[model samples]
Target: MRAQGRAPTTDGAASATDTRNALDLAARPLGGFEAATAGFTLFAAPLSRVLDVELSALEAQGRGQIVSSPRVVTADRVKAIVEQGSELPYQAKVGNGVSGVQFRRATLKLEVEPQITPDGRVVLDLDVTKDSIGEPTAAGPAIHTKHVQTRVEVENGGTVAIGGIYEQLNRDDVTRVPLLGKIPVLGALFRHRARRDQRSELVVFITPTVVGTQCETSGAGDAEAGKRGPEAGGAGSTRQPLCQ
Candidate 1:
């Protein structure tokens, strides 16, 4: 009987492109990878007669619009917008009045890491920070902060959302007379007390896609992809040559 030849095994049959991608990933440093982050603050307040007027004005200009005076502007942006005199405000604040209305702001931040695995899976490491600041009151600013770190494995082209919710108690006092407002027993007669319990949530969304070469092939592709023409295989084709 003639000796039989062995059939090809799928174990070591990875394509050159796949091998190159694996090597590239292994050679890359953590700093070489980059991610995109987006953040915003949401303000929530109890609807009062004074608040209604302010909200109405903001709506007329634009929803979520900010009205700030030049003198009261943030120190950081004072130099940049010195001439504008008035600009939209991102930070919430109370107007100089007796309503005692307060606006609370929610904050969010996120960082993501996508590490490629030889088996075509991605390891996702995430760092998240969130804070909800309550309006200043008789005591002080009410602040709640949360920090989280987590890791998960996902297939290529996947998305994840990480976040948390927090609640804070705020208090304000309205009195027509400044000196009389400080009195203990008699102050109650001259001042109106307002207390609010507010809740806020922070969330961050992240999506990752794998690239086979130093040049990106997704979306509009990299700068070289346009110049490389169809020979670059446009994207996802093995025949295209990768950047050195």
Candidate 2:
């Protein structure tokens, strides 16, 4: 931290020291394959270092009644957005656009072998265990699935997983885990770190077909329309992007 008046306050927070330190450690990579767990611990946690975009629609007015929707945004609506909106087979009924048998998404025991770049960027080398013996499936068609890896970056809360998680592993994630994870102020730091990690894991996306309109819409439809009469020459409502 800078001394009092020496530095001006800014809108964004500075990156944490733990993140930088972990990045340095991850970049060098002292040990061999045996260090895999430790490597992940850094990148995905803070003990190690690891790290690793839209569209169109509608019209209105004499200008085609131009439907000028630049983007859609949502916050705190993750429940409806993810779980309820998961692209599953059940939603695609006979006439619901998608067709054929929708195989239920199966949960597999995924083991991630971590990889790190010279610059400390982390990636995952995935392995699947068919059973307790950790046998690989042979003489069979391979499972086509999204590879889940948490690329860690040295940033605010030390190590952060920049991949699909929490969304997959639903829970309140605090930075440090187990034992010393609950040590007062330091624990608070860990909480921040965990949140930062979780923040890093956030899934951002864009598409032309709009969805989950419930978050933004407010007021009555007729009243909203009344405000946008010919004299007004403005859209009755507006949409904002997630970044906002």
Candidate that scores best on TM-score: 1
lDDT of 2 by residue, 37-84 (tens): 322323333332222100111111111121111222322212111111
> How high is the lDDT of residue 107 in model 1?
46
Candidate 1 residue-wise lDDT at 102:
45
Candidate 2 CA-lDDT value = 0.29
lDDT of 1 by residue, 29-85 (tens): 234443323221111112111333543553465432222212211111121111121
Q: In model 1, which regions exceed 4 Å deviation?
A: 1-109, 117-121, 131-145, 165-167, 175-190, 211-244
- Lowest lDDT block of 10, candidate 2: 1-10
Candidate lDDT values, in order: 0.40, 0.29
